[model samples]
Each structure stands twice: as C-alpha cells, then as structure tokens.
Target: MRSLIVTEFMSLDGVIDSPGGGSYPHAGWTFKDVQMDEAAYDIKGREQQEAGAMLIGRVSYDEFAPVWPTMEEFAEYNAMPKYVVSTTLTDPQWHNTTVLRSLDEVAELKQGEGGPILVHGSATLAQGLAAAGLVDRYHLLVFPLLLGGGRRLFATEVADKQRLTLAEHATYRNGVQLAVYDVLR
Candidate 1:
C-alpha cells in the first residue's frame, strides 16, 4: 500500500489557515507577528520537486492551481498526478488534475501502488481521512506563532483520541521545526 502523507504548515495554536500571502486575513498572523526563519526551505523545495503526486482540498486547489502552475519551480507538481477532493467543483481549471467526489474515491486512490501521496492544505480532507483511519503518516512544519482563527488542521473532537508517534525531527537555522510522525492506532 502507498503511504498517505499529510503535510501542513501549522501554528502552535493549531491554525493551518494561510501561510502564503494576504489571501486570508487570519493567515500571516502567526508568521508575521513573530520573527521566525523558514528552516529547511531548500530541503522542502527538493522534496516538492521530487514528489510523485499531490492531494489537496477544493479550496486549497483553487488557491494553488492558478499560482503554482505558473511557477517554473513547480513543474514536477504540475506534471505529476494531482487529486482534488471536492463536492462543489464541477470543472477543474488546472491541468493534470482530477476531482474526487466521494470519500471512497480517496480510499481507492490510496490502495493503488505509488510513492508518497502528499497532502497539503486539505484540513477537511485530512480530518475525514483521520476519521476514516486512512492517514498513515504526518509531516508537519510547526511554525512558531499563533493565529487565533482559521481552518484548524486537527479536529477538536479528535484532540484526545489521536496520538502521534514521532519518527523524525529536524530543525533548521531558521526557527521553523519539522516533525514526521505516524498515527498511533
């Protein structure tokens, strides 16, 4: 079975809102108010470049499709298989992408043979996968800041039950911290 890895840029307060630009009001609050370096950006860039596939929520897909595809650096992501989990989006403007309408579709995708299935900014999808017991691993970048509001990466209901086993830890010269973990069932 292929490993489903969910990667998130989260705050200490568990806000996974927006880390990119001012597209989200709650976003940038954590990263801007605090002074923190972006650790292992190069390493992340390399990993992104080598990624085989990317899975994202509808909102995230809309936000990323227009920008990342235009970037010269994200060519690998553009060329690779991209899956978007959405109920409302009837047509995907992005090339090399497929929209998944049901949770079962996601499960079937995971059953297929492949490299790591990278999930980025799909909070709802991540939660659903977590609830369905589908997530195999988590690659989290916890920035040092707190945004009081935004779409949370972890569900409030799942706070007590879900436990993670740390498999790897790395910190860069920048304040950013990276931790990889597996969900302890």
Candidate 2:
C-alpha cells in the first residue's frame, strides 16, 4: 500500500490557514511574519523530491493549479500526478489531474501502487482523512508565531483518538521547526 502524507506550514497555535497568502486576514504570514533563512525551505524541496504524486482538496487545487505549473521550483509537483478531491469540480485544466468525489476514493488510491501521495494546503481534506484514519503520515513545518484564529489542521471534535509517533524533527535557526510524524494504525 502507498503512503498518504499531509504536509502543511502551521502556526504555533495549530493554525494552518493562509500560510502562503489567501483571503485570510493574516495571509502570507509564513513569509511576511517570519524572515527565515533559505535553509528553512529545504524541507519543502525535499518533500517535492520525495513525493511521487500530489493530492489536494478543491480549494488547494484551485489555488495551486493556476500558478504552480508556471513556477520553475514546483516543476516536480507540476509533473507528478495530481488528485483533487471535489464533488463540484467537473473539469480540471492542469495536466495529469484527476478529480476524486470522496474520501473513499482517496482511501482506494492509497491502497494502489505508488510512492507517497503528498498532500499540501488541504486543511478540510486533511481533517477528514485524519478522522477517517486514512492519513499515513504528516510533515508539519511549525512556525513560532500564533495567529490564535484560523482554520486548524486538526479538528476540535474527534470521534476517536488517533495515535501518532514522531519519526523525525528539526529546528531551524529562525525558530521554525519540522516535525515528521507517522500515524499509528
């Protein structure tokens, strides 16, 4: 079975919204609020290199599909197979893109043959996958600041407790921390 990895740039208070600038009030906080060294982004590069396919929710797919393909840094992601979980999305313009209707399809995808399906900027989708016990791993880049209010990676009300084991961790000079955890089944 393939691994499903959810990666995010989160705040100290567990806020995962608008790290790269969106409609949120604290948009672009990841770069605007923190002035981290280039090394801090090495983890992102590694994720792109290691990921075999990319999976995202409709919102993230809409946000990324327009720009990532043109950017040279996101070439790996642009080239990889992209799956967007959406019930409304009928046509996807991005190359090698597929729209999945539900989390069950995502679960099926995880069982198929492939490398890790890296998920980026899909808070709702991640939460659903986590609650459904479909997520296999998580790569979180936790920033030092806290926004206090925003959508979080983990939901407040969970039906059951999910256990996770810390696989690796690293702290950057700018106080950004990388926490890699494997979801225990």
Which structure among the candidates has the greatest lDDT? 2
Per-residue lDDT tens digits for candidate 1, residues 66-181, read: 89988987878888899999999888888889999987988899889877788998689999888888888888887777677878888988744777899988876656678889
Please, what are the lDDT tens digits per residue for candidate 2 over residues 1-185?
99999999999999999898789999999999998678878888998998889999999999999989999999999999999999999999999999999999999999899789998988899999998889999999999998999999998888889899999999998899999999988
Q: State the lDDT at 31 in candidate 1.
A: 53
Clashing residue pairs in candidate 1 (N, C-alpha, C atoms within 3 angstroms):
none
Flag regions of model 1 displaced more than 4 Å: 29-38
- Residue-level lDDT for 160 in candidate 1: 45
Q: Write down the lDDT of every candidate, Cα atoms only.
A: 0.81, 0.92
Q: Per-prediction count of colliding residue pairs?
A: 0, 1
- Native-to-model Cα distance after best TM-score fit, residue 179 in candidate 2, in Å: 0.4
Q: TM-scores across all candidates?
A: 0.89, 0.98
